[model samples]
Target: MSRRYCLVGNSHLAAPKLAWEGVRAEYPAVRAQFYGATRKQLGELEVKNGAFGAHLRPTSKKVSRAVKRVSGGSDKLKPGSFDAVILFSLGFNFHQAEAIYRTHRTLDFNGSATAEHLVSADCFRAALRSLLEDSLAVKLVRQIRQISDVTIMLSLQPYPSEAILKDGWKGWTTLKAEGDVGLLQETYISAAADIAEAERFDVIYQPVDTLNSEGFTKQDFCENARRLDLAAGDVHPVKNYTHMNADYGERVLQQLFAADAP
Candidate 1:
């Protein structure tokens, strides 16, 4: 019996065509699918590439809407549908806001308010609390629990690399100065903990923090002295970084399927 997997999220969650191609090579027996909003095309397997690109920060309203779309569109799936669903989101909003503030020294909307002034620890927590209440999280949690024999995995995006940060130093520095770094980490850790405690689902924490252990700090990832266009100095992780995520996914699937065995 072949296993089924579905991935849902924003453009950041969208694996480059090469990543999926690599997945196919590694897991020839498993059927993979994608549901997101990216220009890249999946050559085969099933896909619902309708998700829009946005910053999926801790308290994003878009997360709820995207989850709702997934639940409501369940009927579109084949009779048996998905055995496992992977959600890859929640980091964009914080990073984007940081980037904006760093460059302009002000908010994208109100130049008067700087990014440093806008994102406080309290504000980050409040936004995250609101985001967790959105319909999508509720729906997905309900669906996962209600549906028999389905596994739901909520995985966090890898922390931004120093290589990436180097590419966008000004914005990154402003964000750090505003103390958003600690706030962002706290939000993700707290949210993931809350979700895991509340639900019987699996929460896989990538070894993103370990990157720093390996001497790859934010500076290394963010700096773009290489001046390469491919290295778009933004919060989004580069495709190469996906290797860690993909490995995490593979290990997770193996555990889920092994446990499912009769």
Candidate 2:
């Protein structure tokens, strides 16, 4: 029997959904479906009687339409029925790390960089763990565990485009200026690994080639990125660094379905 996989998350799920169309033929033994909603609505997803979904009814007309559109006419998924459930972009992001770095300096930031609120390595680790544990991704994982013991995989929100630095976002600018972007990347990887071990899920990071030397996604992969409601042609505005185009998705999926991937 073919493997049945469900990809669920917020808007970032768009990338994989679009990419899956071109690559599904290559993986004849695998079957995949997508379920997406806005970040806020994602939290509304509930698992009941071994099925998971947002409630679709008259009062939630907008969410109902969104569910149908992204899911191709389905509102719920029985994760126990699938071979794998990959959760993508449900609020695990590098920005949270940046936010921490902005307020407190850790030993990881080399050189005489002085911050009034320098934190011990142990304190820093505690903060990062707190952030990840509180994230929507972790919460959703715990909820899923309540009903299904299926394999769970996680993919973080795609790294912001390198164009983000050009736009002068304080988080990106500060990290780059402090020579801590690389450290940021390492931190993200390490934190992800720790979460996977603790939570018992697999993680799929962006393909290395898709990232620039600074650990941000290459600008080329971000142009003309679309929103979750793709059918409405909800393309992101210019200089939108957070979202990615289909090309980015294709590469990530290729890595994911590779024979050796977890």
Candidate 3:
């Protein structure tokens, strides 16, 4: 029998979903399903009696509809419904760690020699680990384990587009100008890997080609990115740097399945 896989995420699910939709025919031995919601709504999802669904409330209608639309008309997912579950970008990024660096510099930072308000390396690592532990992605993984020991894979949110530097975004600008961008990227990836190993899950980091020299997603893949609320083929506003276009999605799919292949 073919292995069944479910990809569950927030808005970031759009890329892989659209990519899979376009190229699924070439992979005849695998079956896949998709489930998506806003980051907030994903936090509200719960598994009840083996069924994963939203809580009953006024917004439940909108949430369920969106889920159904993206999930091919299925609004609820059962824990054992698939052989594997890939969690994509439900607050799984280095944003929290980067935010901390905006106010404090760590010893590993390249700019630390001249930087004020420096923090100990231990303190920086601890803060990043704590934030990752408390993230929605981590919580969902733990939640799924409560009832079933399904295989879980995590795909972190795409790094912001390099275009962010052009705008002088405080954190990106600081890191670009003086901080060790490479160290920050490595620490974030290492922390996530450590978390996955401890939890016995897997992680699929971005493909190397998708990253620019500064470790952000390339600007080419950043154009015409879609939002969760947009219809298929629609593009998000130009200012949105976090989402990615289907080309990026296609590469991600290739990376995922290549690693997953027998």
> Which residue pairs come into collision in candidate 3?
none
All candidates' TM-scores? 0.49, 0.91, 0.91
Per-residue CA lDDT of model 1 for 1-262, tens digit only, reads: 7777766544444332224555566556666665543212111112122332111211234433343343333212221366776655433223433343343332222333653455544554555554553424333444445433457665555455554444556655455546555544555567566655777656655434335642233343322211111223333335333223333334344544455443
Which lDDT value does model 3 have at 29?
82
Model 3, 67-161: lDDT tens per residue? 88778787776657678888998888978778777777777788787666799988888888998989888988887887678888998888999
**Local distance difference test, per candidate?**
0.43, 0.79, 0.81
User: Residue-pair clashes per candidate, as listed?
Assistant: 21, 0, 0
Candidate 1 TM-score versus the reference: 0.49
How much does candidate 3 score in TM-score? 0.91
**Candidate 2 lDDT, 1-262, residue by residue in tens:** 5778888878888888888888789888888888778877776666565223322121256765777788898777667767888888788888788788888878768622666588887787779878987888888788778777788888878889988899998767877888888876787778888988898888888888999888889999998887888777778988788888889888877776772244
Ranking according to lDDT, highest score first: 3, 2, 1
The predicted structure with the larger lDDT, 1 or 2, is 2
Model 3: weakest 10-residue lDDT segment is 50-59
C-alpha positional error of residue 41 in candidate 3 after TM-score superposition, expressed in Å: 0.8
* lDDT of model 1, residue 182: 53
